[model samples]
Target: MNLLFLTFTFPLIGWLLLSFSRGKWSENLSALIGVGSVGLSALTTAFLIYQFNVNPPEGGVYTQVLWQWMSVDGFAPSFTLYLDGLSLTMLGVVTGVGFLIHLFASWYMRGEDGYSRFFSYTNLFITSMLFLVLGDNLLFLYFGWEGVGLCSYLLIGFYYSNRNNGNAALKAFIVTRIGDVFMAIGLFLLFQHLGTLNIQELMVLAPQKLVAGDTWLWWATLMLLGGAVGKSAQLPLQTWLADAMAGPTPVSALIHAATMVTAGVYLIARTHGLFLLTPEILELVGIVGAVTLVLAGFAALVQTDIKRILAYSTMSQIGYMFLALGVGAWDAAIFHLMTHAFFKALLFLASGAVIVACHHEQNIFKMGGLWKKLPLAYASFIVGGAALAALPFVTAGFYSKDEILWEAFASGHTGLLYAGLVGAFMTSLYTFRLIFIAFHGEAKTEAHAGHGISHWLPLGVLIVLSTFIGALISPPLAGVLPESFGHAGGEAKHSLELSSGLIAIAGIALAAVLFLGKRRFVSAVANSGPGKLLSAWWFAAWGFDWLYDKIFVQPYLLITRLLGNDPINSSIGLIPRLVRLGNSLMSRTETGNLRWYSASVAGGAVLLLALLLILN
Candidate 1:
């Protein structure tokens, strides 16, 4: 009945309706339900935002306890909803932009055999992500976390008949589970120390209750970071996201770019109180995030598959968000998360348009001069790509990314700032590299012959949003926190303000020269020493996956074989051989049937008689 309840319930209702009517509902009706549900939820979120502005909650925190969900010995985990500026931002992104993506997907996935199924998964993903951001307690957050993971696996493997899709889904789920194990342990430790999973209560009590620099606290924080790293696709755990491109492009737009992948950054931001108490862990997070950002950016550069490049870019961009969080730029990180959801989703969906128009061809080399055939997609791609490259003032990427880099610089983490800069330069190179190679060059293949009004419409909508959303968030986000939290301030400084703007321009210019202006020269260089290395660096993602394969996968397989064959079989075989030998020795006594039986019986009687005589 409450607005928050409506915010959570409507999409679920749509999910149920579509699920029940999967066989009966027409594709158009199904699409409407799928998109409409999230749209209504977004509307509800807008209403809540308005209501919150009219009467802000105490200390910017809002709580609505629905019920006591469960209780154990001296422990209670309640089912409750929380609304704060943080949650409000996430709600808008998840439900609002999510609504737009769903609308796009309706057209994108129109004639697919699993139309209703895809929408069902999308709705479920939205519900889970909403619950994740809005939940008042850690238990429910974990519930939502697992829910999204399940949904990701399902959606990623949507085309289950394909072996590669199934494998990618499995890899994603399994790899993330490794991080979840650490997260679960961390959660238990938190409960043990604090005796509650309520996030607000934790925030209030954690600083006082937790001893600063405590080893156990550091361990717990690090463990939690592992989960965040996996969910957000940071180092060592980032491979799954790049591989997840095997899924449908819309799925990539929703999960990788917009909703699911950001969960890690959200978790760290939500638990800032806890992380702030553990500086060592925070530094570790920053270092890991920096490494991942640079690494993934390079990976994105050489990827020929349109979706794979975007996938790596998503990982790399999330690394920036993590870097912000790691360096105490919590608000900045979340701000990036919001802005990223807009433009990255736009990018992925636009790329999907290209793929669709190209008759499902994804190789950038196979595409050229598509700007004329799909002008809307080209515009959206450019907008998204510019934002990704963090081109100067007013772009969504510029505002959010510049804020992150500024925070990193101010945080006194010079190494992180440098890595971020390098990543920025590379981001521009690869983004425009794709743009030039795919859209600007001479037609490499026949123009995709099919044109539909439905296709271009979504691209146009996303392009408008990508270009404008950055400015809307700047003022409010700058003022979201109090001075005591160390965030009160002068206007948030953009890294690309003036000097930084020139630096950004230089990077863009370099990309233009290499990828667009001097393609033949660049191509020749790509075949040369340093350029070959750079290309290879991008192609193999600096051999991170190969190193992992050698160090972890091969060793694991070897151990598996050893355990399965040698040690286990040898142990089992020893017992079986001993049993066989004993049987063989005993079988000799049973030879010749009746004669042997009589001799044995007589021998036993004589022995018993002799013993009795001796005792007497």
Candidate 2:
């Protein structure tokens, strides 16, 4: 079975069919195609996994090239798929979580206009992301990378009639493009020095050609990191995600779960060799992850919009994955990435159900006492929240999150460890903050339920995975990741685990006190001066939007406004006009009359004679 070809082809075929559906595809059939494409791909991935286990790679890598994609100047890149432990792991996550999200979307988008269009974008994203992970070359991966971005813009701006939704999608597209620029530069540099963009060859040659701490190596990895930070919504590029909440809830789930947002982690992990040469940038990765998580946690706390709250949460959890990578815990990060996909998708889908029940009211502050009414959503949210908060040993998130902290501490970054603990606390605090206010207390308004097997089944599957997959998957992950990549140091500590567990409990207790009961305190604090300041800062994603406005936006706008009439260009453009004038004068000599031509020739000869006589 050509699993790689089939895996991506299924989704691409689905997207192509729906793109030209032209109202021929009914809502039900459109949903079937969208979900079925990914379902087929997921089955293929499982079969590949089974085959790989039965006949492991002799050299720990398996690659197949369907054909040569391009060849120029001795630079050849093939249409190839590379499968290893890493790509296989990502395949499972993308296809599995992706199918579940599509399943939920079928129910969530029922009767809505553009239902077919929504699934089209969803399948396209799946195809692009699959290409990203499975591609054998950097250019191919980059193609898939930008492909996902385009799909993200389309999906996030699906309701393009709304100004806010349009702007949010544009923001996401533009900000990530900034990082793409850096990544493109890095790719150029790599090709210049190493003469290849084939990912496996580049990995092998980069270390062979470039020494550790080489200047070019440092800059190249840093440039690549810029791209990763953008895609993953790490520090400095995270502002767009909160606003991305303006999209529908299914899009949010897809973004956070299986597609675009996770690409950065996959990129860094796939190119782990290049990163190893620049140790400083590697540590920087950890620092960025550690700090970003805390800031994102803080942002999550102040967000009234439920989707925005989850948006911030997604950023923070991805931070943990970054921290793991920085600490040389590659498997740990991927494990977290895997577990995160299941639970985060579950949380977002369940939240979608909540939004549906409330008739599209997104502000958790306006929702109350919905637990009994939306029992399935309530239960799913609880399961997802536990995983998000990493509730002790029971949840999948605990295993992944704990490994990162242990590695951070053992690796001698105690400060990062402490910061991670604080982030964990805030994660719990905000998660329950939404849960208590939205699902508890007096009813704010009537919320009609949207019932379906489609809705509940996906939630149930994800809930089970989030609850048990962590513990089950943890032991085997050590073997799945190749020995060459990396491993975290030191033995696991019961004390450290206990301390982290206690912190999570403390956060839950604090949230219950602060937000449970009357919840008037929530408002009172916000209305206070200090609270107002914190709320404002967090609401604005720590003023990154404002800071970028002052630093980049305002200046660009000023320049464009001053140049609106384009005077400088007009002046430069005058050279062409002057040339035209000179042409007109010259054309006078050839005025279609022999007498005029002769007279002009005589005049030129006389002028030349006069110049010669003066010189004499």
Candidate 3:
């Protein structure tokens, strides 16, 4: 129990050592400190898990208050850590998957500039993510939330020599900041009405204070959903994620798999009680997820950049999680979150190896016939891709995603259920499309697979986890979250699972038909008029960036251009301008005209005398 705090401490110590070294340390030394710290954190988590299971805490909830912040009118939010089944599951994902990503990064970032600096940012990212999932109160959680945002900006722009990387970093920072503001407002609303930011206390108090669908409660939930949508890259806020791949492949894996993108799912699940009070907002959550999954799925189909396809896939998968959350399948949502961390991290790392092998060639159309050269990478992709496509009972994604779809169907959210089905098909199609095109076609470039132990070890481990073994490890959420309507639909559950599985298999078959040996048919269609239009549209992510430029960015640039001279400052300067004008006119009276001055004095004296006589 006492060791729970060590999870955060180890990562902090790593960041401090790497950061203070200022890139003076040797690569091996820097990697030791960086990877060792997260390794220690992962070890601590394992021990804590053992302790937690062997000796369960009272009510399966353990709260460790480190200290009080300040006292004011019955408001003293302490720096506390909360652990339960839900947090424990999230903790495992952050530290366990985080350690793997860090390990792989040490290999992936070899010979790169600012290697120590990269480790520093990644270590700090792990620390922030730990705090995000473990914090006991909303205030503490927000503290971690902002920290994760800052670390992402730093890591995404790690290759700052490129102007576009910096822009990508800044874009991610600003877009997520919009969501942070809404989350902050939501926290304030919760505190104002409930008088506490402690998550457990709020859960107990909210039902007592506000009835179902109370206006204040509804707005609070709505504000929280706004935060979730932005952070998770749903709908309008999703544009930053694809560009975010401008960073290192490890950063992409960290963001997409382990850290920044999953924060929203954790936030919503943590505050499930509040969302439950507002069914309308809850329904909106499902609707947002459904729309985002369908849109991102189509966009992924046409993306040629390997990393961008995975980026869109992350968005779509998270959309499924959100849809699960909206339909009241809390456990199912988190179950998929865990499984996703396993397979998605594997895909990114495997893609990183491929990218490095082909001399950093990222365009899928440019690479081919490397399956024999990079056997490990090819195998990694097959396992990870199968899991991603949720290929029936053999992969981790199948069990978790199947649970989500079944819950949606059982909950009577037929629209959401169908959306999940479509997303499943698209996921399989694009995943295999990348796999077949990149690994099986005519060779277009020379390749050398990464051979070091650091490079292959992480991939080997993640490849195993992406299989059915990973799916068997269910999170201990029996009492932590609301139970899904599991096993209630009887034979219908079997039918839905079988249908989703077959749909996924069909997508793979179609991808093979279209992308494999696709010199003629697919190319011909892509060149045709309507095909060109649709391909271009999907390639640009359905023109969200263009639409946003027209609606927001262009107008904003125009407004700034019009105000380039500081018109507000000029308007406020009017008072001083008028005063200066008066002073200029008054100065003329003192302009060395003695006769005029004497006449003015005589007029002033005569007026005073008349006033005095009238008063008398």
In angstroms, give how far residue 585 of model 1 lies from its true place: 14
Rank order by lDDT, top first? 3, 2, 1
Residue pairs with backbone overlap in model 2: none
Kindly provide the TM-score of model 1 when superposed on the true structure, using C-alpha atoms.
0.89
TM-score of each: 0.89, 0.91, 0.93
C-alpha local distance difference test of each model: 0.82, 0.88, 0.93
The CA lDDT at 216 in model 3 is 92
Report the candidate with higher TM-score, 1 versus 2.
Answer: 2
TM-score of 3: 0.93
Which of the predicted structures, 1 or 3, would earn the higher lDDT when compared with the native? 3
Q: Which residue pairs collide in model 1, if any?
A: none
lDDT digits (tens) for residues 1-616 of candidate 3: 9888899999999999999998999999999999999999999999888988999899998888888977899999888999999999999999999999999999999999999999999999999999899999998998899999999999889899999999999999999999989988999999999999999888899999999999999988888888888889997789999999999999999999988899999999999989888999999999898899999999999999999999999999999999999999999999999999999999999999999999999999899998999999999999999999999999999999999999999999999999999999999999999999999989999999888888989999999899999998979888888776765767889999999999999999999999898558889999999999999999999999899889999999998988887968888999999999999999988878889989999999999999999999
Q: Give the winner by lDDT: 1 or 2.
A: 2
Q: Give the per-residue lDDT of model 2 (tens digit) for 380-454.
A: 888899899989988999988887888787778888899899999999999999999999998897887777788
Off by over 4 Å in 2: 474-492, 572-616
Worst ten in a row by lDDT for model 2: 482-491
lDDT of 1 by residue, 1-616 (tens): 1578788788888888878875578898898888889889989988888877888777776788889988779787887998778888888888877887887788788789889888888898999998899898999999889989998999889999999999999989998888898899999888888888888788888888778887777888888998998888898788789888888888999987668999998898888878888988988888888999888887887889999998888988998988888788877788788888878988998888888888899999888888998777888888999888888875788877877787777767879988998888888888888988899777876655334555566566667667756547642333343211224334444323554556666777877787774478878888899988888877887787788889998999998977776876789799989999999999888777898799899999999999999999
